[model samples]
Target chain A: MKCRGLVSLLLLCAALGWVLVYSLWSIAFNPVGGSLPEQVSKAMADSGVDHPITAVLLNFRSYDTLLEIGVLVIAAIAGISMARLPSLEDPAFRTHDALLDALQRWFVPLMWLVAGYLVWAGAHQPGGAFQAGAVLAATGVLMRLGGMPMGFLQPGYLLRAGLILGFAVFLLVALVTAVVGDAFLAYPAGTAKYLILLIELFLTLSIAMVLLSLFVAAPVNDAPESQEGHQ
Target chain B: MTPDLFYAFTGLVLFITGLFGIIALQHLLRKLLAFNLMGSGTFLMLVGLAQHRNGTDPVVQALVLTGIVVAIAATALALVLIRRYYHLAGRVSLERDATDEGRP
Candidate 1:
């Protein structure tokens, strides 16, 4: 029976592969999309960023990035709501390893430097809020593993505010533009660079906070399981 | 066969593998991994197809970056939920009979 199942799985894989290849071939042969690269380049002067990806993310399609942050905030909220771990640092995770302690002391500051650099370099090169936030989150996770206490992540108004700060700031920018008789999220002439930089800074902080909180909020071992919602 | 097409084809294979794994695997964690594999495959396809015609499309790349961050959030949330479910149920698989057998 196991052999038969394996064979059937292989057959299914083959069938799907063939179908996908055919579709890709068809799409490649008869392309219907226009030249977006050219269009983006043409509008690059007004985007306030030298990097095309950064410009697209922060200026040309700011709404999508804004909504994406909102989604992340929602996910963090759900994570913390389900997280009733009872303490900031779980006993199971506590350790006194000298190597990890040394590593944390050495690496944490370096990671922070890299994250800041990524945000600053995003306007001209291949770095941005998302990348910086991810690095920051990784650093937080490392700190947690080394038993560093994160008191702010405790379920409180501070954690809640940090999680929503990026989304709130982005929305405020959009609304401000609209109030000033411009389209929503449209940066005014001569102020686009500063606005993008400010938004990126807040966004990096909030994104890092959201991801790190979610990581910290995961229920630890020895958590007393409840039967409240069980059938 | 350009690099773009090669990556696109590789992504197709990953997508199929992920689809099969999601269907065949019994463990919820493995299923979640498969779901992520599918997501990665889709992202690859989006970038590959866009760049196959237009050299270096940053718009799609930015969109994929957003997709990646969103995917991480989703995966993190799902993991928490799964861990909570496991704590409550004491089973990794979601089959009804498995739970019943364990309880009984």
Candidate 2:
């Protein structure tokens, strides 16, 4: 019975793939959207950033970035709430690899420097808050695996504040700009660069916090087994 | 064919493979992996299709960037949920009748 189901499912998937590929081929050959690159280049001067991706993310279509950060914060909150571990630094959970320890000693500070550079380089290049924050989070995860004490990640006021700080600040800026300027997220003349930089700074920190907290919130082996009838 | 078209077709293949994996695989973790593969395929198609028309379009690139970050967060959250489910049920797969206590 299971084999029969699998065969049917495979056949259905093959048909679906055929249809999808046909649609994509037609769409790819004949694009429908107007020349967005030309439009972006025309408005690039007023976007307050040298890099086009940065300009679109932080200036032109900032609403998407803002909501993206909001989603991260919510995910972090959910993960943290679900984490019921009594202690994060249980001795048995530590990995005592000599090579990892040695490499970590050499790599942590370098990673931090690279993350900072990425954020700073966002104004003119491909690096930005998301990339920088991911690097920072990776560093934290390495440190955690090496059994470094991360008391700040403990579920408390500090963790909560760190999780929400980026989204809060971004939303605040959007509201302030809306009230002061002509529309939401429209930075005032001459301050767009500074506003964007400030938002990106907080965004990097909060993004790292969210990712790291989610990493640390995974249930450990010591969690009590769920009783069959218990909630 | 242009590089964009090539990558777009590659992404289409990955998307279909992921779709099959998600439906045919019983393990929650495998399902999550399939979900991510689907997301990557979609991202690749978005950038490849958009840039096939306009060389190096930043708008689509930025959208993909946002998408990548969101996808990471989503995958992480899904892993957390899966881990919790495993802890509670002691099973890796979500079959209804396969909840034998010692068979994780």
Candidate 3:
């Protein structure tokens, strides 16, 4: 039986290799390589940002980011609905691992600092709200694994605010810009930088919260038994 | 092969591997991970194509970044749906009941 499985896997790999070769040949025949157009580059510059990606994410296509934030919120809400799920007799994580606790005492704060730095550096370099939010969520997950499942399930007000603040702020700003006679999300000429940062700050907070909630709400607590639950 | 071709082919291989895993795996967690693998494969292709030249295209990079964020959201919602299914049905595999094969 083991040999049979290996044979099938080898067969699958061989078939997939042919597919890869076909794909590579096609790309070699028709290459799709080009730099950004001059208009886009000039537009990115005019957006009052040093980083092109930050400019695209926060200025050029801000609406998409807003909807992306909405998607995250909806996902978090769905995940949180399963928070009342039935876990195993033993808790999901070790209630107290001294080593984990000792490390978290210092590491978590440092992690937050790095996350903040990522958000700040986004103004010019590769780091940004999403990177910072992901790092922040990593700390949240670490804290939970360190016996504090409540790290993400903090007070009701904080939870609601963290989840809604980003979406609400983005919407409000879009509306304000439209009312001011600019397009939706078109920052008043000179104020694009501050507005983008403001939007990113809220987005980072909400994204961190959403990811943390998603991790806490996953139903893999009874994972070991589930592995053998089938015939 | 040049680096661009190499990386693009690697991405395609990753996508195919994830597709195989999604089709063959019975475990829901494994399936979820395979989906993530597929997402990453797509991202690798985008970035690799953009890297065809010396400097990467900011527009493509931005789009890929957006894709990553949306992918996470989709995965989270998919997880919730899977968890709920398990809660109600008491199993993780998407297979039909043994007796229900060939039903309309």
lDDT tens digits by residue: candidate 2, B27-78: 7888899999999999888888887877899999999999999999999999
* Per-residue alpha-carbon lDDT of candidate 1 for residues A1-231, written as tens digits (9 for 90 to 100): 767998899898889889899998787668676799999999999999899999999999999999999999999989988876665456567777899999999999999999999999999999999999999999989988897777777667777788898999999999999899489999999889999999999999999998998888788754355644353
Predictions: Cα RMSD each: 3.0, 2.3, 5.8
TM per candidate comes to 0.92, 0.93, 0.81
Instruction: Name model 2 segments beyond 4 Å from true.
Output: A31-33, A87-92, A95-99, A223-231, B97-104
Which candidate has the top score in TM-score?
2
| lDDT tens per residue, model 3, A1-231 | 746886787688769778777865776567455547444677876787889888888888888888989988888887777655443112555468898899999999999999999999999999999999999999988977887656326536767788888899999999999998568888998898898889889889999988887877776555543554553
Q: Give candidate 3's root-mean-square deviation (CA, Å).
A: 5.8
lDDT per residue as tens, model 3, B1-104: 56875676778778878877886666787889988998898888767765664446777788889899889878877887787677667767787655233332
Better of 1 and 3 by DockQ: 1
State the lDDT at B39 in candidate 1. 93
Single out the weakest 10-residue window by summed lDDT for candidate 1 chain A: A222-231
Badly placed stretches (over 4 Å) of model 3 are: A1-34, A37-39, A85-94, A148-155, A219-231, B96-104
Candidate with better TM-score, 1 vs 2: 2
Chain A TM-score compared with the true chain A, each model in order: 0.89, 0.91, 0.77
Q: DockQ scores for all the models shown? A: 0.67, 0.75, 0.37
